[model samples]
Target: MQNMGGIFGILGVGCGLYIFYALYKLKSTGDITSSILLPKDVNPKTCKDKDGYIKAVAPKMAILGISTIIYGLMDLCETFVMSTGNFFWIVLVLVFVVLIWFSVTVSKLNKTYF
Candidate 1:
């Protein structure tokens, strides 16, 4: 149980950092050909305005990444300070909510732009 928290924390923080770096590169380079969160079927070439689309999506993804790190931190808290009951379930549910919210938001963006 304790080990799981450490693993979740490390992986979540790493993924969040990677998301930030990728968004930076994407925005800096005007390269929207790929995305870590977006579906591959979301053709960048089909976007009405490439820069506009990137601007819209980057923030959403950044939010998701930040929430992921938060979830990870919550897991770490469970491992260290909190007990393994309500806090754990709460964090898990929150993470899933964040993920679903992100997904819905991105889908809306896709429909608007692509």
Candidate 2:
């Protein structure tokens, strides 16, 4: 109905703002506050340190981006799919838990190194 347009607008703005904030923090704090939390898909050798440690930022950002999109997708799906009981709640919880864990783990690991 009329609310769908408003909801779409809000989600678009929210996604844009989240990206803007993350990018700004990356520049100002030198820390990517948000990254994709995903299993690496590349060759292990490609991701490494001097000792060949498998670590990278792209994957994290990709995961984060995917998660954000999923949240919106699921939110919309709820209206059509009665099986998806209140997607917003699940998405909200997942977002908070995943982001908190990801941010903390990344920051702690960073401190241990440089």
Best by lDDT: 1
lDDT of 1: 0.76
TM-score of each: 0.76, 0.46
Off by over 4 Å in 1: 3-5, 80-88
Looking at candidate 1, the ten consecutive residues that score lowest on lDDT are: 30-39
Q: Each model's C-alpha lDDT?
A: 0.76, 0.51
Q: Worst ten-residue run, lDDT, model 2?
A: 45-54
- Residue pairs clashing in model 2 are 35-60, 35-61, 36-60, 36-61, 36-63, 36-64, 49-53
lDDT of 2 at 34: 26
Model 2: CA > 4 A from native = 1-54, 78-83
Candidate 2, residues 1-114: lDDT per residue as tens digits?
A: 335743753583467457556645554554434243222443322322412111444345445555666666666565455446565678767866766865676555444433
